[model samples]
Target: MGSVFCEGLTHAAMYARFRPQVPASLVNYILSFLQEKCKGPMNNAIDVGCGSGQSTRVLSSHFKNVVGFDISEAQVAEANKLEKLANVSYKVNRAEKLPCETQSVQLVNAGQACHWFDLSKFFIEADRVLVPGGVIALYGYQFPMPIWENKTEKLTKLFTDLYLDSLHGYIKKESLDVYYSNYRNLRFRIPFEDYVQIRNETLYAEHQATVADFVGYISSWSSFQNFQTQHGQEAAYDILNTFETKFMNELGVNTSSADTELTLRTNYFLQLGRKPTTTTKRGNSPVEKQTNLTH
Candidate 1:
């Protein structure tokens, strides 16, 4: 991922604090392939471009062991502050260059951060590290939106213009724009596409969010961070502050601490594939266990 996305300690902290997690149902969709593989060391999975471990922790519940990597040291540092799970570990590393031994992993997944990666390199690394028939899942949720009256809709448009206006030249072709524009054709590389079983879907998660939560979430965006950098922080935040005022006025709600616990719905674009295999041995099998394991 880019520096603006997860580089500095401050931005990294905000991202960790506000980013919603990969929904459990979506995680189940990825793990459903290996539902039988529930037990043992053969169920190793990797989460690439894992910023601050929100996605990593969810992956650990299914896989016997999970390794999460990000390019930012500060993001990894922030991720480590989350409650430690027995099966999860995080590190600072690149998505294109994985450290796992060849065919040593049962699954690989990335959440909300693949667009920043070099897809060709990431696919090659995934191919090298995955065991035959191992699964690779990449999924992302769009920005959460509060479902309110007409003012909520109009206010969103107003704030969105400000957000994009601030990001004039900083936009890149390979960033989240690609995901939002045409996720169906999001690029992928060899062996997996040709030989792997691949598919895509949308997943959902529901939350009741406060106005403060919504504002904090918006502040966590990479584009917003870029806006803060290009314009001064005060000028950037002024957009959000203005929106908060509009929100309260239009909705007839109190601005007590800028917290409005309103219902927000979140959904994800999920792209999943499995590596090809010659012989299939279900990992959950009571008797068949692979001797070679890497962590």
Candidate 2:
């Protein structure tokens, strides 16, 4: 698992360059939940696995002090270059052995990167670093929207098959459920108080995008990167071209510059759990048992 995670870090630098549009409504919902549930002011928060710091930047607005940490030095450097906030900083650090002192943080968050963690160790570290009544929130969701045209569907399936074949043990789907279940079983786990579904009410949005934009976004996936690297870039390009041709012919539109509307069905689990007050010391804290979340 450690080796897989390290390999993932190698490509983390590209994450922000292929930025996806996240809904502001979703961000607002999460921040509002934290403000209500957390004990202290949302002044100090830590973002774990903060690749490219997209989510971390959003967190900065709600928290007085926000630090985003990732294992990849390259990723941290890239995040540093893109944006600067008065109260937010980015660092390279391991999630299992966080650099923060005990009981110093008000909130600890992981966005789309919790699946790579050693959960038992991570929860312990989270518990250690959070003050009593400090809230730990974990949220993630699937990429691209659930609604798919036939051409897009074929391309997505082909990409998934290629990636699974390449990485024999990686669990691509169900990542959010896996992390949520892990947190639910922890001794200090707090019940989720709110749930948010950020979806477009209409099939189309006001802003338009071309088919090429859709293709580029899909190609930016980590799985697609592995597929291109292992199977050859020519093959990946061929598959993408075929899908794009199909869309153009059927829809009478070019994807790259078209004004087509796209909607995303993003589901977020906004959970807030308080740190236990009387738990054993950091070193002596009872280890949480591990259960297999992948099937």
Candidate 3:
């Protein structure tokens, strides 16, 4: 947890290419909640741990300005390389200390990246930067389940087994734990009000895949880098290939036919909190003394 495993340029690029774009439906859902609590203009937003700006760019249409922040310079660089939007930018920064001025942001969000943060510090920073009654959203997806025409149940089990059994050890314990829990285990310590948690096992991000696309997506995993570092690329990909073979076989498709089509369906979860409109405290709020450390 001391450093981001996916900070390498190669991994960052792969991530930018393969990671699911934050769905518009999900973004609207978060914004809907924000609108109810904060009646002010949607001036600015911060996308925390925004790898390659997937979540950041999605917020551009919702806010006047949006910035994505990540600890990895490679990630920020990759994000910046994408088709630029005038109101969207990427910065290399930590989640615990956002760069915006206090009370200047209307929404703070992290998609599939909040588990890496020290939530306590992040919450305080989020609270500090958000306007009163602003919203904070943390959302992510579970490992994708393959739906092969009508064999969804079986294919899903196979992919789930591969993830939970073969790749689990390589993944960080905290990350895996949160994923299995659908992020229900995370604590929101910002003293937020009107908290809402959404768990939709039916939600899915559809992707058309080739063998290479499937392999590349798996390779983009942060845990895969750890596995590759320990076992070497050949040894690591061997496992992926073996699973790919099984998956392709399950669909009655030849492994040689790399373009065999199947849809990947993934579940989504969302956690939201709104800062209190009124705090009676005079000075030195809990958010102001986060860790007694500088970002």
Number of the top TM-score candidate: 3
Q: Which pairs, if any, clash in model 2?
A: 210-255, 210-256, 210-258, 211-255, 211-256, 212-255, 212-256
- Give the residue spans of candidate 1 off by over 4 A: 1-9, 34-42, 149-152, 166-168, 189-200, 279-295
Could you give candidate 3's per-residue lDDT for residues 72-178 as a string of tens digits? 99899999999479999989999988888988999999889888898877887888788888888888887766666788898678756766788888889767866
Q: Write the per-residue lDDT of candidate 2 for residues 1-295, one digit (tens) a residue.
A: 1121123333554477444544566566556655564545666889999988887888777778999999988889888987768888999999999999878888888876676786657876787787665666665554444234545565455534534553333334444344345334343243222213222222211223445555565565655666667787666566666655655555555443235545434444444455544545544444232212211
**What's the residue-level lDDT of 270 in candidate 3?**
79
The lDDT ranking, best first, is 3, 1, 2
How many clashes would you count in candidate 1? 4
Ranking by TM-score: 3, 1, 2
- Provide the overall lDDT of each model, using Cα atoms, as 2-decimal numbers: 0.69, 0.60, 0.76
Model 1 Cα shift for residue 222 (angstroms): 1.0
What does candidate 3 score on TM?
A: 0.87
**lDDT string, candidate 1, 1-295, tens digits:** 0223323448788888778867888887877765443334557888888888998888776667888899999898888887479888899999989999987888888888778886666776776777766777877776666678656576566556645575545556655464355355535422343444345556788887677767777777777777778887767667667766666665676555245677677767777776665433444321112111110
lDDT score, candidate 2, position 71: 91
Where is the poorest 10-residue window by lDDT in model 2? 197-206
